[model samples]
Target: MIVKYTKPGRNLIMVPMLILLTGVSSCASRPPSSVLQPVRLVQNESEKITLLAITNRDRESDGKGFGSRWAAKLTYEKYRFSIPSERKSTAIVYPSKNPDPRRQFVVTARKQLLDSELIDDATSAANFDGTVAVFVHGYNYSYQEALFRTAQMAADASTLSPPILFSWPSAASVTGYVTDRDAALYSRGELERLLGALAKDSRVKRIVLFGHSMGGFLSMEAAAQLKLQGRRDVMAKLQIVLAAPDIDVDVFRSQLRDLGHMQTPITLLVSKTDRALTISSVIGGERPRIGRLDIDDPMIR
Candidate 1:
């Protein structure tokens, strides 16, 4: 089924860095253009899968395409998505698998001119429950990694709600940690725009904001921004989940004080064995990160 977008609302100002589209092929026969890769691919075995992603990384001019799978599929063989550091917001549809090499397969792809209300309309139309889970990735993640992770997590959860990925411009390298951290901070405004749109949409009944590692920092920041904007109605319908958050204990405590007691439940998932956090602790002058807290400590109690 081809999903189309209606007119976008006037208030939607946040630009979606990437848009993904997915549809099923009617026949089992392999497409003539299908090239077998040596390694196993995620979703390679599945006949149909739902894919949705938004990314802000610079586009590549090479044949490989953008960080998003659906965007890569939709982009022409040249594989261009967005320009390097282009701030113009865009939304595009996924390309269907086509067999003919001679004919262009991606010409039919179109931008999803959208606003939050339009997004809610589409989500409401897709599922009766009207729940949308937004997943934000942490530091050192390439755009593709974030996209695939969200897809896999959503599949594992087996939820009726659609999964959306909000990927910042992470340097995607261990050495780039500092740069990624700054990028994460810079991304707060964009995140706010996205969350605000989703929150304001009437058709959206529930929203789950999930973040991993440094992404947790972004999530909490966005949550605080929502509260500051007097968008408690939006916060009321949200459920915040932070997994292995890479946040300073002091910062976390401050965020809590500002948020006060929230109507929405916030679930924090932490583990001592998280090596990344272990290294982070060392970098931060031996102070324990929030993700690696000691519950027995009186301060924690």
Candidate 2:
């Protein structure tokens, strides 16, 4: 009886309902999922092979160029038993190339990658001293930033000697965090290679490696690789210093364990005020490692 009373409007309602049903059915009949999209894996190979020649205008301004030459000459004269006048004469002939201001000190540090001589020179210096300090930079740092940081650290720490900078191409863009991380990882193998080469020189006293932010992870990875190679003696020469490392504390600890009783002392410089590392911790979905412990924390101690 109700159906008989139903008007044309009621029939029209069914038309709209049918249309909706058809639409839904069409949508449902389509592929259940989007086609798997291929993701491009960015390789940090570009940064790995890079070598940057460091030159600074400020070195001249600060008289570091003159001082370095003087130091070199003085050492050559006193230690090598050569005449100071002869060494000074040679230094004058070389004059350290006026400390090339255009030469990149930090950003595109890979320029030296092609130069075996430069790498050899660095390695030679490290081996000669029996100790070397390698500095790695964090995210968003330019070549200048690396150079300035290295210089500052070298100047500040009297015991921190023979500063060598392993500059990775950071892109130095805040938005390029992923790229920067990839680059840091990419260059890790190179760092390992460098350390391995240095280790061959028994003359090397110790290797003090300093890394800030992502550099910390790279340093850890490099050290771990060195340890795994049965070169614990080389690892013994490694003193790893991490400053506001952008790494999961757990992961970092695991890396340390992998290093397995390195004679090299590990030190971390963490400050709760480190804003960059704090953001990294949040993105990584973990507690801020820097805030979780101080230098004297039992976990670290």
Candidate 3:
């Protein structure tokens, strides 16, 4: 796919909010997203979408949900979510303390898997063309949110590749812009290791990396890091997709310069009228973010 760059208009500052404030619900009001919500295991097997999760977030001591704290080591696991069969044209339904398997998305199972074991599953579960999709979530996302989101996308998409998620330690709050940014940066080495491991897998032939929002920034940083280390093998098998990336335009340009020529062209999805980006722009010293793109700009050309 083609990577298109766009410039933001001068009116982005009018929205007048911060990229850090989102909803009315506090962290307390929200149900535990990572706790394994009950589901009829045998009967709901058909509705299950399992994810290969690689995270650097510290696991909560209760073993229910993954907290936002960063960890010194990365962990690999597989989580299975049962998609609600009774939903209409709605988004993912997060399971609460008491959830209906037929109406809300529920966490059916969780398993801690070895890194090599995950690679084996990923290699064996590739798409027809040997493509493995890795999803890197954006800012203010908890582990369960990222996990279920990947499952939702997998269930909606046409591809048969098994879903994989690269979850960094996001503070999981609307006010976590700076916190999430630092956490994403700290997890770059972990992401590099995940990509490198997939590249080294003999059975895996192609990899499609998907990043949204701030995760896109982390993705670019890891790619640059890999290039500096001269990991041509990993770069050869990788294809990048950045959707609504929350990256600074100048930073992205510099990252591009560092990456040089890629084996495959990067695909970027951008919008000119994203109000959320306007808030982010104002916060970033009124500098436009990449997501607020205007492709007609001469510099983009």
Top model number, lDDT: 3
TM, every model: 0.67, 0.57, 0.86
RMSD of each: 13.5, 26.4, 5.9
- Steric clash pairs (candidate 1): none
lDDT of 2 by residue, 83-157 (tens): 112221111111112222222111212122333444354555322545666777777655444544443344334
Best by TM-score: 3
C-alpha lDDT of all candidate models, in order? 0.55, 0.47, 0.73
Worst 10 residues of 2 by lDDT: 73-82
Question: Where does model 3 exceed 4 Å of error?
Answer: 5-29, 41-46, 126-128, 273-276, 296-299
lDDT of 2 at 66: 14
Clash count for candidate 2 is 12
Candidate 3 per-residue C-alpha lDDT over 1-301 given as tens digits, one digit per residue, 9 for 90 to 100: 2364422222121111112122111355455654554454444544766678989988799876678998888788877777778855425567656677777777777788998889877766534456788888888788877777677767656456567899999998877778988998999999999999889887778788887778889999999999889999999988887766788989988889888888778876666555545656777898878766666667765
List of clashing residue pairs for candidate 3: 6-294, 7-294, 20-174
Q: Is 1 or 2 the stronger prediction by lDDT?
A: 1
Give the winner by lDDT: 2 or 3.
3
Model 1 accuracy (lDDT, Cα): 0.55
Name the better of 1 and 3 by lDDT.
Answer: 3
